[model samples]
Target: MAHCQFRLVNGPPQRYIADGVAWVLDPAVGGGGALRNLGIHGVDAALSLATGKLGLKSVSIANRIHPGPVEDHALLVLEDEAGALFIVEAGYTFASMRPGGDFEWRIVSANATLIDHGDHVICATLDDAAIVDLPVELPATRYRLFMRDTLDRLARKAPPPVSIEDYVAAMSLIDAAYQKAGP
Candidate 1:
């Protein structure tokens, strides 16, 4: 992909402790907020789609909606070695506690542009204005599918789909963004 944009937003967790601390908002408890919790997936996807290694370009973090020690929203811009750009946005600032909140993944290339708006996908040609709506049949419980795949791989003595190195690399990118947006 020449360019990719990803976003995930949701309202803050409804449940709070007796002390009025939402676990996700507690630094000690959650380790980090939206960026670490939700945005890492975007980072991983961006990295996978990138033509080459990605480097952080810019970062912005905020806790305006739910002021606390942790940020409720984050935006990250990354550039790949091949000059591709990736933008990632994650937040816990949506107004509702809906299950999936709002999610979108848009990718642009020389030939076409693909946009996935959680429920459906749209593809548009770059040369022409031709657009097509793609159906999405996502499982209600994806964890079951994940587990099945993982177990099957283990039975065959194969490595997991997502390796430890991938996790570390993603986390390192997130850490870099946090460091760049230092207190």
Candidate 2:
């Protein structure tokens, strides 16, 4: 059996993130605070790519930067049924050196290791390596894509890229992780 590892990280406390936190930093209302709000998406994507269908074996979490009502930094460690490891580090507290988003995703497989750094994706193998930039046409505005897909579906059009059921499953994982983290 072969295992693939995926990791995604983006952080360093930018104003846009802080501004957006105003709308989503509630622990009472949501299942989690910073980890759930900022980290769930990356977890979802990494899990999906790591396992076609998640056979989640176990989950654990470590929380940091808990200033007030909610945490500002969290580390999530998960195991798939196949025993592949998945770790997601999410935070809103940091001093950034770069001006742009600090986003990065890496996929490590037996044959190759691929990395996505917003503008480009790089693939490296024992034999060769290459980097291909993402087309400007395809931006990372997931909200807009979701809205458009929902509208299209409602209009009796194509099926949505992801269904609500998928979201529920992802949230379940986040919920389980938080549960294990405890109060």
Candidate 3:
């Protein structure tokens, strides 16, 4: 069971927990936090990213009001002086730096879909599919460490390193592994 907990330092204090850490979809409560701000625009984009189709009929947070389908969605939140921070409580499988931690593990999924969120951008996709069937026993800490490493690596470069071919290759392996492992 991949376990993950998300906490926003500056924004409203909101937390969410999930399994597997891929597609981080933890329920949200009313607040100004990242999850809450995942308003209609963001939600629509997420749905599109997940299903790979546009024209989302409607979207609601906890079954609220859904006006209509949206054209685009982006789930990123950038602060004035905070640089760039991607609010990814969904569609991810990794943890990040902590107050006290020496060693780290990298377990980030390579798959992702880009979404243009007007001002910023958001990527929504499954974590690397490799761990699909590894086992529920895998520690959540592993995912946290993976996320930490991914973000740290991102911070070190002017333009992050990404290869669609590599991502596709990794995802294919994950798919094959899952097919063989699943019943």
Off by over 4 Å in 2: 1-23, 52-66, 96-100, 127-156
The per-model lDDT (C-alpha) reads: 0.85, 0.59, 0.28
Error of 3 at 93 (Å): 22
Which clashing pairs does model 2 show? Answer: none
TM-score of each prediction: 0.88, 0.72, 0.22
Model with the higher lDDT, candidate 1 or 2: 1
Better of 1 and 3 by lDDT: 1
Could you give candidate 3's per-residue lDDT for residues 53-75 as a string of tens digits?
Answer: 22222221211121112111222
CA displacement after TM-score superposition, residue 183 of candidate 3 (Å): 46
Where's the lowest-lDDT run of ten residues in candidate 1?
A: 13-22
**Residue 2 displacement in candidate 2 (angstroms):** 6.1
Give candidate 3's total backbone clashes. 11
Which order, best to worst by TM-score?
1, 2, 3
Which runs in model 3 stand beyond 4 Å of their true positions? 1-53, 62-132, 135-139, 151-183
TM-score of 2: 0.72
